[model samples]
Target chain A: MPRISKSDVVNSTLAFITLILFWFLGFWLSHYIALPAALLGLLLLFMGLLCLGRVPKPLEYVSQFCLRHLSLFFIPPLVAAWFYAEQLGNNLWLFLFAIMFSTFISLYLTSWLGQRFFGHSNQSVSQDDES
Target chain B: MTKVNTVDWQSIIQLVSIEQLLWITITLFAYGLAIWIYKYFAHNILFHPIVVGAILIGCIGVVSATPLQDYLIFVRPINWMLGPVTVALAIPLYQQIRLIYAAGSKGLLVIIIGGCVAPLLAIGWLFLFDFSDPVKLSVLTKSITTPLAVDTTNIIGGIPELAAGVVVITGILGVMFSKIIFKLTRCDDSRAQGLALGTVSHAIGTARAHQIGAKTGAFSTMALCVNGILTAIVLPLVFMLFG
Candidate 1:
């Protein structure tokens, strides 16, 4: 295992503080605005952090770690899904069909539109799966 | 071997209950197992971790009669992490800003079209059936990712939980059928495909896009952020004016 440093801890702590601050902003703003507070906070914080002159190196590492395990956060919601499972009752097929069909249409239309209208002038044909 | 009759295994098991620790252990184990299965099957879309884990937990819940509330009690920590996890998306967004700017007006147009068309298609399809308003609303936000999808649905007076479920399902479908859609449309542009996947399917499609290439992943991330913002602003206003 690699040695953990104090700077890394500080950077991660600062990043978390930023997240909490934004989350609270979103939470408070929710009273007046219709948008989800945490999401709005996320957007605001992203812009702020992006525009900052001195971006912390540790922040990047911390954020990468969080994003890599994004699915872990989703597990709770999936579990919460059980509460509403009964809501599907008889329309489960309809629900599934609707989601599948709409997604298919959306993907088709969006991509087709991108290709048809925008062309590939800016797109590179080379594949770069370096990650 | 026949002398150990005094110990009651049932009492011990009941006394421990195991519900508190069960959530963390079972969920991680189930997700890990699901990923293993997915890999074992050569990353078959059918064996996606989310789907498999959900099924595994669902079965366990049904058989064991574990109340959803009990699960929620221990799962709260994971749920609480969502806010921070969402905030972390900003890092990718920041990194991809240059590419997004490079696309310029054309990219803006694509994002707008995708933002509107996704939910409109949902609304139109639901209308064809006899679905209730809440159901329609839930499906309306299916195109975006979870945090934004839940918010959009909530603003539109829809069921947020239902929207979250549908949003996840939409992502899985996007991952599974993207190739077919690309073939049918004859759109060989990987950038365009990434944009579509991210705009319509969100994270799952982004994961697929990354599999395709780095450029595709960047474009997909751009689309995910842009579409999320656009839908968050546009969907409710459209519903209000002409719903």
Candidate 2:
């Protein structure tokens, strides 16, 4: 096992607290606003705080690690979905076809427009790519 | 089923909460096995861990006669973690702010087009098929990430479960097929590829972008965030106007 440092532990704890705080904020706001909007609102607030406070190294590490492993977080809902799978029994084919078709169409159109208009001239775009 | 009801099983059940422990262990083991399978297969898009993990878990449920309600008792913690995980996305969005600015008006245009057309096309076609309102509403937010898609679906009076499932399906399709689409279009620009994937498929698309390059991942994150916010706000309003 890799050695765990005290600062790393502190950072992870702080990151956990930050996420919990935003989760509560989202819960509170979900009563008034849509849940997505409330969650997004909380995310933006977190971002603003990070900027104003100058993100700590530990927070950065925790967030990036969490984001990279984001799929793990989705496992619960995906599994819970088993409960409602039967609801989709009707028109399931239509749902599948429409979703797949529209997704491809959206992908094609967005990329085409992005390629034509964006052109990747900006230095930041190049810098990120190189990194 | 016989195995579960066997005399030997009765003794085991009396000794402990066999059903709860069995389901919990099965869920975790399924996820681990799925990841191993995904890695063994070289991360083939079709072998996506969630898809395989769900299948494996479902099989266990069927074979053992374990009810979904019973399984959920042990699985709900993983479900609740989604709230904090959703908030965790802020870190990436914050890091990618500079690139978001660099994409500029072009990024805005792609988002506007994707954000509007994705739902319109999905819902319009479903309307023609005469699907119920809830089904149409469920599929409308299919292109966004699951967290945002479920929430948006909830507010718009759509079925959250259906929305979540469709979102995952759309994401898998987007990741699996994007290679051919990108090749046919000769879309060499990483930003464009990332934006397209992020807009259509959300996190899975971003994961694919990461595989291709860092820049693609960065731009994809921007696209994911923008597309999510747009859909979350736009879908409900559109529904209100024409629902």
Candidate 3:
């Protein structure tokens, strides 16, 4: 396990504040337009980084940390499953079937489409074996 | 278990409610434990941390008769911070774009098709079965990331909570059967494999893609972002015109 050092704390704090600024800015902008605040913030950050031509070290550290544990954030809304109990119970099999069926269809469709669009490029095939 | 229940959970909730920090710590600890279980139990995707943690929290809520709103309140900070976290996603998104300049519009085309196809198929399937409009709308948002799902659901009059739940299930199902799908289809291109996972499965699929390899992770990240942004922007407009 890698222990977080003092510098780690400082860097994450800085990264966090930067993200919050973007988040706030996005929220403010979303009032004028009709985009999701987070999406707005994300685009702003991306464009800002594009201008910089590189990710800042602190931002990189924070983003990696957040993405690694992204699943944690989803758990709260997932508790809504309890609220979904009544509807899910009545259509349990149908619900599962629809979700799984649609997922598989989408999954295979994308995979096949990916093949059609990207599969022919043998030069980039080097990525296949390395993974 | 009976003795555990003997303690007045109501009073405990009241006491803990006074100091929000206590509940937040407990919530994080539950999620951490869920991850530990996933790590120790042969790493089965079946016992996904999201699933297990939700179950644990549900149990606590049910046993105490705490409403979902209260639990949400207790853990509100986590939800509040999601804004910055979601914004932070752009770093990885931007970085991946730079890494895979060769993919370019070809990659975007694949993602757009996949993103649109998955949701349309889901909505059509729901219509065939005569599932309610809200369920159909929620399912339409299922293939996107959770945050985007919430936003899209809100736009289309779907239940955001249900949309979030459906998104998780979709992602898990994506990770669950990806290997079989890959083998049956013989999709050997890393870009293709990653794009399929990211576009169809969203963030969860991207996580699985990362486990496959660095190149795959890069492509998957690109697919996740492009597919999400496109879906978020285009779906609402389509609904306005046709819904």
Candidate 4:
């Protein structure tokens, strides 16, 4: 049987602890540290990533784990948005217009430009690779 | 004297109720549990634990009437992770430095033009519809990630919170349709796909770009970082000069 690595234990433990810390931090910040909470959250996130990098050959697995379940973490915020539904309702037209217009515009431009710039580079790289 | 000593526990208990602490613990444990489950069955795309967990939490919040704000207080820490996740893209980015450099001034020119044109077109369309200034500004920031979009919205006199909502909506829509759009446009090249997505749709676009392959994802990540900074700087100045 393969020995259970110390790094594996540490990575799993850290990921678990960070999730809880993030929640408590969010809760505390909503009441006590709105802006600071956001700042601190960003800070902790970077720290967590750094910790993730220190883990072994299974780093990809760890990242996949986070990505797969990342949306679960945002539920609280969505719920918070719901609580403010009345405010959202009052500004429905503005919100609708903003979301719709921005979505189309952003998607179109990003895709189009990304294609243009990267296409040029890819052509050059492939030519080099073939040679 | 003994009676006097026993008189004041109720107020203390009320100050920090066991029930509230229990609720907080439960919510945190749920997040941890969700992560574990997602890890267990990581192959299925639709069953993405994050989405599943979000839906579950949202349902629970609705049933409990636990003010979203109260839950936000507990969940805000997750948002904090956004910064690191974003910056970490720099790692993949560093590996692609050669490709970026080789693209050179020509590549820079293309990116700048595309970035500028995309937002202009978006804002122009909104203007045609006679949307309010706040709405227009919010739309302008939608092509970037939520954090940057929120900040850009504020600088340009739009509501940051409103920008956040727009960013989420924009990401979902972008992710859903961008591939179809790419196919329709006959854009089969990875680099072009990445840039177009990153420049126009922002993070969601980048995510879509990644789905195509590593080359596309790398370029999209680059586009996201560059476009984010460019728009943040340029949008405010454009508004100042023109608006």
Most TM-score-accurate candidate: 3
CA deviation > 4 Å runs, candidate 4? A1-4, A7-98, A109-122, A127-131, B1-54, B84-86, B117-136, B151-157, B235-243
Model 4 over residues A32-124: C-alpha lDDT tens digits? 532323333433544565565543334334445554343443445444434443565655665465556555554555455545655445447
Which TM-score values does chain B get in all models? 0.85, 0.87, 0.87, 0.71
How would you encode candidate 2's per-residue C-alpha lDDT over A1-131 as one tens digit per residue? 98899977987998778777778777877667544744665466566766686666666777677666666645656666656666667667776788878888888888888877766564545565422
Residue range with the least summed lDDT across 10 consecutive positions in model 2 chain B: B1-10
> Which candidate has the top score in lDDT?
3
Per-residue lDDT for B1-243 in model 1, tens only?
577668888898775456656777888888888878878988777877777887887777778887877776766666666776676677777777776777677777887777777677777877887778887888777777787777678888898777777777888888888898888888777678778888887888888888787778888888998887777777777777887
What is the iRMSD of the candidate numbered 3? 2.4
Every prediction: chain A TM-score: 0.77, 0.74, 0.83, 0.53
Q: Model 2: runs farther than 4 Å from truth?
A: A37-41, A50-53, A79-90, A120-124, A129-131, B1-25, B237-243
Ranking by lDDT: 3, 2, 1, 4
Query: Residue B243 of model 1: what lDDT?
Result: 73
- Assess the local accuracy of residue A61 in candidate 2 as a C-alpha lDDT between 0 and 100: 72
lDDT, model 3, position A62: 84
- Ranking of all candidate structures by their DockQ, best first: 3, 2, 1, 4
**Which of candidates 1 and 3 is the stronger one according to TM-score?**
3
Say which prediction, candidate 1 or candidate 2, comes out ahead on DockQ. 2
lDDT of each: 0.76, 0.77, 0.82, 0.57
Question: What TM-score number comes out for model 1?
Answer: 0.86
Question: Sorted by TM-score, highest first, which candidate order results?
Answer: 3, 2, 1, 4
Error of 3 at B241 (Å): 3.7
Query: TM-score of chain A, model 2?
Result: 0.74
TM-score, prediction 3: 0.89
